[model samples]
Target: MRRRISVAETAPTQPGTTGSFTTGEWWRDAVIYQVYPRSFADGDGDGMGDLRGIEERLGYLSELGIDAVWLSPFYRSPQADGGYDVADYRDVDPLFGTLADFDRMLQTAHELGLKVIVDIVPNHTSSAHPWFVEALESPSGSPERARYLFRTGTGAAGELPPNNWSSVFGGSAWSRVNDASGEWYLHLFDTSQPDLNWRNPEVVDEFKSILAFWAERGVDGFRVDVAHGLIKHDELPDFEGITGEMLEGGGNRGPMWDQDDVHEIYRGWNEVLKAFDGDRMLVAEAWVAPAERLSRYVRADEMQQAFNFDFMTVGWNAGRMRDSIQSALATNRAVGATTTWVLSNHDVVRHASRFGLSDPSAWPKGISATDEQPDSALGVARARAATVVMLALPGSAYLYQGEELGLPEHTTLEAELRQDPNFWRTAGVDIGRDGCRVPLPWKGDAPGFGFGPSGSTWLPQPASYSELAADRQDGDPLSTLELYRRALLLRRELQLGRAELSFNASTGDTLDFTVAGVRVLANLGAEPVELPSHHEVLLVSDDAAVDAGQLNSNGSVWLR
Candidate 1:
């Protein structure tokens, strides 16, 4: 009883035929691949990855089928907060490369037709920055001290600085200036990374100038870091109803977190950034839920994209994933805006490792004896499924580096090696994101894993992934790397996964949908189930099979 698929079938475009989609037009259906430069690939033997390393691997990215590459910070800094606290905006860190090397990397990226976006930390600066140093050494805070919120002290009145907002990494958000005067500075992140004062007009100009500097050099847009923590409540105000800020004055300042008018400051950047993003594509790390509240960032005029972290914390069940998508998607539509979905980044443990696909425990089994490896078959399949799900959803999709090749995380911890402020505060709990940020294995059973000189990488390459080296698997048809190559080709070839998804829900953790005339059905169950009779099966998971008239799966099915 074969039933015809009603939708018209259009001829598909083969992979790489779009040649390489420019990051501008690529924003619509684009899948952004995020790369943390320090761990990606090393061109020099300096024990760290740099631009030249990236330039050598441009073809690999193109093959991965990402529309853009969102590279993490490489700006000059003291390595406090891993380059988030930038001292010089224009120059590359010596460990990373020179301006000439970066220019070549950008050029190579463009030549491959991939858009490039770098991390922009707007909220803070390294205390060692010229501006911050000048402010600190001066008898009185310099005029540029206004560039940051320089407060001698705020009366601990009004809801106690608005409900006493707690600092992210522990302790108070306020850091004291060790100058002749006892002035307090705001630092929502690390004390060394002091927050900038966006209220100051010059501060806005300086930030906007940085945007212009990159956009002029052909970068598509920026992945703005800690974007929501920009302009916080002024005058040390109390919370609306609550007596004070949330957990304020434990040796910290009150108004260290969210302020209402930060949106206005964002609007100014929105105006300036429009010229760079073709779709005005600036992605904010606005780490908040409730689209209505976060909608202000994408308010018909602000950010083109913000991190859709709703899905980050969700589970493996269909109902859970669906709700995560519905909230972010439906909410954005209601606000007449859009957002992007990202599962993993440099700040968190890799999703593969977290979900037990890479290992039995949530922590990475990095280069160590205690570390347990992933269920290989299960892990690779799960990674592919994650990619499929991400691409099929609406808005933009983000794929973390090495994720395309089913890269497992490296999570060994050395006693003297703990750097994240969280471990010190949380008492050995999960704090630093060391596992996901390890070096990318590129050659040999591992060629220094291609991250740096032999034995010189910032983090050790996991023994588990030596065989998964990018070079070894590149041409092998059966390699997980090849599977991703095919997946990327299929994603662009069909162009169906990039569109808005319309779901048909009847509860019961059931998800059914259609993409370009192909029917997709997933039943997160443990028993056999019969799907509607008309569809023809393209693939199925578990022991289920498509026979005669009925489709069966306890997992998933793609049909036509």
Candidate 2:
């Protein structure tokens, strides 16, 4: 419906032995780990986390050399906002289990080669979804209340709320409908959820039949949820001075968000993910703004990837991380697409306590045990030098579940065991996202550290998560889960996700570059630097004092 295509010969390249084009679309440069399924791994001991606790942690995400896992929303939810309020995009959520435990956890994450990706909210549902309880007993403009965004109310007699759009978990984004037939629905997040109507064709054949019922049950893609808010602005306008600041990407041209009819609903969800043959992908948690309008949701045909969030909201400087990775590789190379890189997810702050606080751009939207605590050993040394500069940056890199055990953000959570709807829609003075959604500790020392087997953890795992447990840094070679398992096994023995980075001439506060030719560096100065004339170190977030040639200060290297 919006056709502006050119996917560069159906995109997928990855064969590289050094020639540098790299897209064998295994999500082009794949490292993707995210999880957050009720705080990953609780296998039936039931402190939550299920799907047989992610099939007993698919061998700990295939020994952390992750190639794909995503998860985040075990569907059928009533967990209000945690599961992003969904209600049944075809089942699961008996608190996460069954559809035969999600086909035995997608057949053990495709027998451990991994690739799962799930989470597809489609801009709202779960007002107890039976089509929102039959559009709350239908009749308003019936057709079962035209699949959602209900309307019909605008002041006195009708009683206000047909405009001034708000609620991203705060207040008035419509709601009203309790009978008297005065109607009003919308819900840009939580009045139990609602909001569907993408100009309803029965909400586009019920999400293309919920994306062919999870791509015929193999599910290799779809992170969508609020992917640029499903088509709005046909009229309901009235947004002046809406300082919700477009939820942080800050440009705020909000007509209920990035809506060029939401790229014809992602080119009809990239034709339901190219009718699945398993190369399937989708990625857009689109908080769209100056980040080159997220390259029209990864255009070529639509959504092949979209989550740079301007390199996860830039600011741990080095010329603002090389101008936000050269404006996200010139806006995803103007649409050929594939440039993901992330740092911290489950909605923010755990770039190891936002790189030890002191105003890492005032991270706000919730974080307050009287705030200012950060600096836990300088936030695990700049979150281990920002995960070796986001896994040597070339393309895909997601990793959020416990940040490979470098966990951090439990920023003092306790307002009655808080649970994020941005802190009950700001009633508690915004201390939400339950300190980066706590819960994963995995193994000994107390209180569900093992996250189940009845240790019982539904968010409170702190005491410094017993030294970032995963059985105390699984074979700690100076841990951070063995530096993300030796930088994802040297990012696959140096294919470096199909390599090609470049940059080089940097000096103060380091960050030099190179990728196919390897190099990398980083420092972001406070101290050490001098490195270059390489030949081999391959990976080193901090080899205990690493300096025969320097690089330390918040360290990160990769040389070769």
Candidate 3:
């Protein structure tokens, strides 16, 4: 496959009116820190980041600097699709914690000046869920059947999927309960996550109940998963350009990807969020959407924000970073909605080791005596550059859990044993996300990846993580961990993420620009380049050793 290229144009970098941007208080300038619980700090010696563990780590979040925290789903699940296959919307799975534990987390997070946002899987419930179970046994017109998108009397029939669309996880988008009814349920990702029929009024009201369930629990907001794929064509149109990847296992195409119907559904959800006025935030995960197309979901009547992966998609080059930032700004402004920056997430390789900044022969796990270390100062410099670019850009800056510590990518295939379902799906063809999702290193010498020494862990801990653990580097003034703290603190101190871009231009690999007159610059290159006396320096990655005349490697500065 040649790979599909996105057709999104970049945006300008000019400062506009203050209230000119969307006036939503919850996210106007908030930093959404994403916590992949399984890999975060493990509490209870389970090697998993449980609710109580997250509660204990709230101070780490506040200290690192962030306005909101987006927790990946912890709901009751069967692990067929992580916790995304929700068995119950209102309960936390035992693997993570209980419902009450979640309550304390939200309560305390709010008390700490941080907002608690949970993942909302509105599109489907686990096949094992009570409603799905009952619907499996019921006849048409039954009340339980109304909860899902169940269609009958079609062939290719139950053996085939509901449509020609493809599941993102590979295989057909649909699955059959039996041959008797000869109908299939739709799943956009995995078969376990049956796509809900949003056209059904009952489904709408029921989700209203689900939303209220969390909002009532004192949760601040939600990170909407696959938000754009919610609504189908209403006719479930045939999927076009289906490839071998799309036909991984069987024959079912899932959601109406990038279709307009999704916009209507988002608008509906925003209507529900409006009930909370400007207090609630709605951030959608739309990976392929361009700024122009994505803005449709962020209108005042639609969504509060959408995840902006511009930097995430670009190569780790200063020129690219500068262009991406400027283009993203110009595109979003043209579309009438600004973007929220997303540098890394659970799905991709850690940027610390992925950018190939070092010699190709020294690939992390394959390191030899002569090659540079995987997270060499060069790597650290690039990671820090990524931070400066993210924090100084307009809109929200999201920080993934380990990114603050500049956590390196895993060096061993042993990380495979950590129980990532994506790995199980391929039976080893792909490096399971388990490496990135490993237990967080807290105590340097503690076993279970410092989840605890001699403590039980849900996943096997990495042996080499001691150097990267919080215990070892917290006080080290030159460590990557300290630099992250400074980057986040810098983000907070300037409010530049909230301020519009006043200026941006060529200054070596440095993406030099200004926000609210705070001139910000970052050198994406490992070897920094100096700039003319164009502006003064406000903040650099605290780790970088450089002067105003010479932006010597990993250098970042914000001018007043």
What TM-score does candidate 3 reach?
0.85
Error of 2 at 481 (Å): 24
Model 3 Cα lDDT, one tens digit per residue, 1-560: 22211111111122111111233475777777888876676667655678888888888777666778899999888977668899988888898889988888887887777888889988788899988898889876777777777775355434555557666655667777673675677776777788777777787788778887787667778899877666777777676744213232112234465567677766666667667643777888765444566667777777777877555766566665666676668876765666788766776656666554454212122222243436545565667766766777778778778877777666464533545544554454445465566667887776564674346666655566777888887857566676656556666556676677855556655677777777666666567476557655545564333453666666565555
Model 1, 192-305: lDDT tens per residue?
Answer: 888788888888888889988888877877898877777776665543222111221111122434456777767777788776545446888866545556666777667777
Q: Rank the candidates by TM-score, best first.
A: 3, 1, 2
Best by lDDT: 2
lDDT of 2 by residue, 1-560 (tens): 32211212211233212111224578888888888888887888768888888888778777767877888888788786888887887888888788998898888777767778898888888899888898788787789888888888877787988888887667788878889798889887668988888887878878988888889988888888778878888997888755256455534467877877778878887887787786788988877777777787888888898888767677577777788887887788777786888878887778777778886545565566787788877777778877888888888888888888888888777788887776777688657677887778888586688887888878777798887888988865667787777677767767776677888898566788888778888887788766766356666776543566766687776777
Error of 1 at 172 (Å): 2.7
> Weakest 10 consecutive residues, lDDT, candidate 3?
4-13
**For every model shown, what is its TM-score relative to the native structure?**
0.84, 0.34, 0.85
Query: What is the model-wide C-alpha lDDT for candidate 3?
Result: 0.67
| Alpha-carbon shift of residue 373 in model 1 (angstroms) | 8.9
- Every candidate's CA RMSD: 5.8, 22.2, 8.0
Provide the lDDT at 203 for model 1.
Answer: 83
Model 3 regions more than 4 Å off: 1-24, 140-143, 151-159, 242-255, 334-336, 357-377, 415-418, 507-510, 525-528, 534-536, 542-548
